[model samples]
Target: MHFDLPDLRLFIHIAESPSLTQGARKAFLSPAAASARIKALESQLGSRLLYRDSRGVELTPAGQRLLQHARLIMRQVDYLKSEFTEYGTDAAGHIRIFANTTAVTEFLPEVLAGFLAERPGVTVDLQERLSRDIVRGVLDGAADLGIIAGPVQAPGLQVLHFSTDRLVLAVPLGHALAQRQSVSFNDTLAYQHIGLHEGSTLLSFLREQVEKLGGNLALRIQVSSFEAICRMIEGGVGIGIIPESAARRHSRTMQLAILQLDEAWAVRERSMLVRELDALPGSVRALIDRLKQGV
Candidate 1:
């Protein structure tokens, strides 16, 4: 089907946004115009693209396929614009990166800062997601690259070693589990917990692990940041599971204890994933290479 760049841009925005109106707003189109453009695109392709419902919009199988290519096409267009317009200028391209919370919170900041400083002509669009979702987004071409942690499987994508961070239980200094050197997740579930909010990947992973073992946590408090959770743990509120990178730094300043988990999953190796290494623009590729420095 012959659709213009605006049509494809609108389609990609609609597919990624929570609602059509929101997508239209992002695309700088009115709702009516967006709807008409979508209809025109679908008619050209001879298939439905999106399924609309009360909750929001979901991509039809065809829509999903279109979205995958749309992202790649947009990236190419962006690259072309950057290269042509800024031939002699410093900044040139955009890099879209999707990373898990662990990577974002613990490691990516320093690495990304270094890359951005070295490559001033490049801009970055970074979003946080769960490890599995990061892998899915990369494979689907929704993002140029992804950094994920935990034992996630990405069948067809290229995965490179990124970094490692241990997950541990943070307990009050005088709490029962505090003095223990290493404890299993199951062994700690019976105690009250201070966890990240429900939608966090870490929280979901912990709950799934507990349920599989026929145990559950009594989450007494939920907080938005690791610092808040650590504070609650130090106040004898409840135990919390947090990345060792964050917990260790806070441990020296707070009356909190870090207990390692006996489970193998506790020590996780993070990976940086890409759909195709060679297809990336030069600036984006440079950033990726810099991120792989220590690996």
Candidate 2:
């Protein structure tokens, strides 16, 4: 059915929120205005698109089918706008990127610096989020790209590996394990451990690895940020296992020590994740190409 872009966007927003009022708020339109748009769309398509009840609005069969096509059309429209605006310039446009805290703090500076040097007009907006949230942002079109820890399983996205990082054990300089060249997972369980908060990918990965080894991690404190975890470990709250790059940086600033985990217990992977590989804008594509070349 022929539909204007604004009405389709309103419909998709309604489909996602399922509350006319909530959708209107998100779309920054009055409820009446939003409802009118939906009605106009329904009339043009000659079908009832929504059913309202005490439980809020539910999409009809036609609405469900149209929702899929609507999303695709909206994405293409956005891409087309970005493409036209970005043409004939040195990657001049906005690039919204979502990366995990560790990447934001430790890994992305060099890459971002280099990217900006090459494409001075391109504005880069980067935010730190959890790995899962990073993936969601990219898939939902809220972010142009994301860099996070690997092995994320999500459909309709392409994953690429650019670098490998290992989880290292960090402790106070005076901790008994500080001098050890390497320690095992069981060795870590002996001490009180500082860890990332529950929903974190690092925490979940460590938990799974420990569980697979028929053991459980004994956490003394669960902090929300890597920087906080490092600060706590440095203050002697407890030892922590964090990405090697993060640990190394903290080591330079504080009296912290790091030891590589035993090979079997070490969780290491090329820092990788999924994104729309083919749909990336020129600026994003340039950055991805550099990453692929290990630049």
Q: Pick the candidate with the highest TM-score.
A: 1
Mind giving the per-residue lDDT tens digits that candidate 1 earns over 103-133? 6666778887877786677788888787777
TM-score of each: 0.89, 0.77
Instruction: Give me the overall lDDT of model 2.
Output: 0.78
Prediction 1 TM-score vs. true: 0.89
lDDT of 1: 0.83
lDDT for residue 37 in candidate 2, whole number 0-100:
91
